[model samples]
Target: MSWAEVGQRWKLRLVQVDWYLCLGLLFLLLVVISLSMGAWKLNLIVNDADALPIEAVAIRGERARTSDEEIQVALQDLMKRSFFSADVNQVQDALEALPWVYQASVRREWPAKLKVYLVEQQVVAHWNGDAWLNIHGQIFDAPKRSDIGALPLLAGPEGQSKVVLTTYRQVSELLKINGFKLDSLSLSPRHAWHGSLDNGIMLELGREDKMARIQRFINVYPTLVKQSKPVAKVDLRYDTGLAVGWENAQKESQ
Candidate 1:
């Protein structure tokens, strides 16, 4: 071959070698980067294994019936989990499961701590014969206590707790204006309503226009209570008037 042809062939071989070298270096670079990334990911996972453990738990709330020991017992299951793995929602659910706890909030503090806040149920009245009613009319069962005897008794059909509670508040407030305090209120299965006052007087508020009936009784209460005999029962089922039953008066006539 001629010298010029030899030189051209050599140039072509050098160019091919240069291209192969570039490709090989690029492949090596990619391999190195992949290994480095894998090592970095592995290091991160290993470090997470040593993440701070939960060391302390703080519970905060107005606790009257539910004690701190009870709350701690509820959190026992959660204590098994790492600080990062523990779920706030699960904690809250556990706390709210307590009989007197109305609501619970849970949060994770930095490093190794958990914070919990709870709202206890506010007893508004005694429900049925076993449960107690909160201000929101939610019924919950709790251990019987003597201190709760003063709360007014409320009874109704299932699922009517809220309605009964609302009506009780309205009626009691109206009664308060007339210097009467409701001791107990009840709604019969047939929807009839009745109440007993603190003064031992029973009120019969029949269904339909019960509020108006009650208002009528309130308007005439002062005059009726001023009579010689103590009032025993006041039937407010009439349109314009109420039937007043005097204590011992029926026995005297007999």
Candidate 2:
């Protein structure tokens, strides 16, 4: 071919390359725009307050003291939001705030529901006359109902519930073997321990070696009952022997 014809062919080839590059860039821009629109649409659906509304809360676990009305009250405002927006931790906190609820777990089921598992406090004794002590030695306050009057009474300073509870269990077990039921237990500010039996006999357990002291009382219990009057009180604070006070005010040192 001639030189001028070859130059013209080279210019045509360069124009074809530019057109292809433009088409490729246009396709990539279209893809990016489509992806952006899809993401925005998805965000609208996920964030819409009317979507995925929570309609019910399924409460599980054994519930005895926790009333239905109490659960409703705790969840009323929390469940108004969409399921995805609802905070499980907040729901759990509300349920656990109830007087009888010991622990609570909250979770979201598929679609639009909440599952709440609650654990109720198991009351074992009355604490300091107004509150209650659970089996775990935790103190919780509830209404003073007629049914709880029969439970054993335990008293102690703040933050000593576990200590008092442990001692009460140990002593009660020993006394129960001797045909006695521990009715009340108290720990003094001076760290002294005292207890009363169902039969109205008082025990002064003092500061230390309380279990050993109760054992000493059990050993001499049969001999003490032989007295003419019922024993009113027994002081087990001594190292080797205990003092007995009769119901008739007759006191003797064993």
Candidate 3:
């Protein structure tokens, strides 16, 4: 209200601005000097990377023997310190390119560091062509024999591999509950699904409401098993009901 009060208010505002300026300069110095120091230098100064209280490599693994192009792009983006405008996506995209990685999510753990969460690829199916499909429906070359798992094998066209892999999982579970074993499943380009049973029968399920059809099959499997029905194959595609071809009289007697 008075000139003296106005002067006091301006003085306080100037002090706050000066405080902010000092904090900004301090941060800039840390980025320029501290971050510029190499891994060796940091080891000499800080007891550990975690002790630094800002940057920490949460996961440590040899960056999955990839080409230099992808690694260089990831490293360059990580070394940047502009803070607000660090192209985070560029860094994440680079990391995601690694064959061992299924999905990678990057988050700024603020005041200093970035956190990376990698859902490493878990090979669910071993493809015939020396490759595997990750749980995320992504395909990558299989690791060494020591690294590959004893999972089921799936083979199909390149563009349709994922669809086949995912659908197999669903149908295989369906069979397991009904005390049946699955051989393999194939997906046609026309969106039709077919499967083979371990008992040497080729079952075909046409493209349609998959859940409803599978539910119907699950419900009727026990009856067929009880009738000792020699079911060679059970086709659930027909609108009326299931069509089961006879397997043999031995199963029928049982």
Candidate 2 at residue 101, lDDT?
93
RMSD values, in order shown = 4.7, 3.9, 13.0
Lowest summed lDDT across 10 adjacent residues in model 1 is found at 44-53
Can you list the residue pairs that collide in candidate 3? 230-247
- Measured by TM-score, how close is model 3 to the native structure? 0.48
Model 3 clash number: 1
User: What range of 10 consecutive residues in model 3 has the weakest lDDT sum?
Assistant: 48-57
**lDDT of model number 3:** 0.69
User: lDDT of all predictions, in order shown?
Assistant: 0.88, 0.90, 0.69
Q: Between 1 and 2, whose lDDT is larger?
A: 2
Q: Rank the candidates by TM-score, best first.
A: 2, 1, 3
Ranking by lDDT: 2, 1, 3
Compared with the true structure, what per-residue lDDT tens digits does model 2 show for residues 131-157?
999999999988766645488999999
Better of 2 and 3 by TM-score: 2
Candidate 3 local lDDT, 95-205, one digit each (tens): 787766666677666655666666666767776558777776777873555645366667677688777877888888877887877777766667787777787766778
